[model samples]
Target: MKNHNVFIALLHYPAMAKDGKIIITSFTTMDLHDIARPARAYEINTFYIVQPVDAQRYIIQKQIDYWLSEEGRKTNPTRHEVVSMVKLLYTYDEVIEDIQKNRGTKPVVVGTDARPYPKTVSYQFLREEIEKRERDFLIVFGTGYGIPPDLMATFDYILEPIYGAGDWNHLSVRNAAAIILDRLLSRNRC
Candidate 1:
């Protein structure tokens, strides 16, 4: 299994549209729930939902609070265990800072895309690197159209796109993030 120091971020702000503008997308409650459960199940350290909008962030937090409440916990005990791992942060800087403080050093920022990118690395190599435990990693996933080009440049390495059987190459950010993490972390399954 990959080290638990690795984190995942679901980016909502500083993302892109089809046009050349940076936009803040709204949160999908289901995606937040779906992603977080799998993350905790897969033993990921933390799941950060990076949103700049206060209203959107409030809604997300409320949902999290519900899951953490006594009634919600009684309803689904395992889910409560996982949703507890979700952290709502406003900026990339907060994620970076938190990782640095927790890991006691800077992390290797990795970005994911639906298309090929420069400095793309293979999953096997990334998995191997994770086993070395030399550094922590934060893998960022974009929701809307995709991650912005400038944002892509910030990453130390971009993971190659997740390919399907055909040329069609779109997936819910939740599914993509879960699949990517599973591939990188699953030991016996692989």
Candidate 2:
């Protein structure tokens, strides 16, 4: 498929904790590698790591910097390629600003969640929407429990939950991202 103006934003701040309190989630190093791989495979424009904490952002930036360095590239060229597409930012606003600055248009923010919201759209509908490619698309994924309800209300669309054959639906952010991307961009019927 042709490269789409699609970006992935993995948010770590203002996420809902298990206790229903808003908290900042820790950035996972594994998510950086796992999410970027499928994103690159699907020809996404960029993969953004959104963390508000300075320490967390710094740690992720260090890893990104190393991966783009000569030694890291020499050690793992494949990883270097994927890491090159990751942009670490301090807030969700920065993500939108960066994309707007680069793309000359604000992206259509699509939120991913484990539960269906009133604005939830099907995978097939979203697939058709992004395929239009009239505007940039930013697929947002939350860490910890999930993005809070108030924040989710501002998103352009919330994708329907990825259900399985049974009632169980919890999925790792990385796995959900890969599955969601495939469902939206894959050649086969979803």
Candidate 3:
């Protein structure tokens, strides 16, 4: 498994390239401060908010257990890799408030893995609209019970869901964050 200390260090310094690109990592895990760090980094940020009903210690423990399991060990490998592998999870309301607080004139927020799928479209359209207006982008994902239907309706996009090939869902979030960060960084190079 990833060394907890290394994961904490990455959270301390989320890689930000010279261009105006930002990557935020989050999960259904215990470190809220780590998740919030990225939000503070980007003028545009993404969040994974968990539903109130599912914000119990048991769920967090489950995530922790998954992190320590054999597959988790394989995925994280070492402490230096944990920050790159997992996201710091947050409560739904906390995410919304953070977005509202950090959202500037040009901000986009995406709620991924939402039900009904249309929310994803909304996020895309919102991005287009924000670009048209020359605004920033802020995206949010839902964890635990997932985003509510009403909130999902307002998302700028819905991330394509990736079912684990027999692994835990939490791992999917970590992998997604890494992929997203890679894409964002690559595009920024141009």
Going through the candidates in order, what is the number of backbone clashes in each? 0, 0, 21
lDDT of 1 by residue, 148-183 (tens): 989899899999899989998899998898889888
Per-candidate TM equals 0.96, 0.96, 0.40
Best by TM-score: 2
Model 2 CA deviation exceeding 4 Å by range:
none
Candidate RMSDs in Å, in order, are: 1.4, 1.2, 13.0
How accurate locally is residue 45 in candidate 1, as Cα lDDT from 0 to 100? 88
Task: Assess the local accuracy of residue 90 in candidate 2 as a C-alpha lDDT between 0 and 100.
Answer: 87
Candidate 3, residue 6: Cα displacement in angstroms equals 24
Using TM-score as the yardstick, the better of models 1 and 2 is 2
- Candidate 2 per-residue C-alpha lDDT over 47-137 given as tens digits, one digit per residue, 9 for 90 to 100: 9998988988888989999999999999999999999999998899999999999889889999999999999999889888888878788
Q: Model-by-model lDDT, in order?
A: 0.88, 0.91, 0.40
Model 1 misplacement above 4 A: none
Candidate numbers, best lDDT first, in rank order: 2, 1, 3
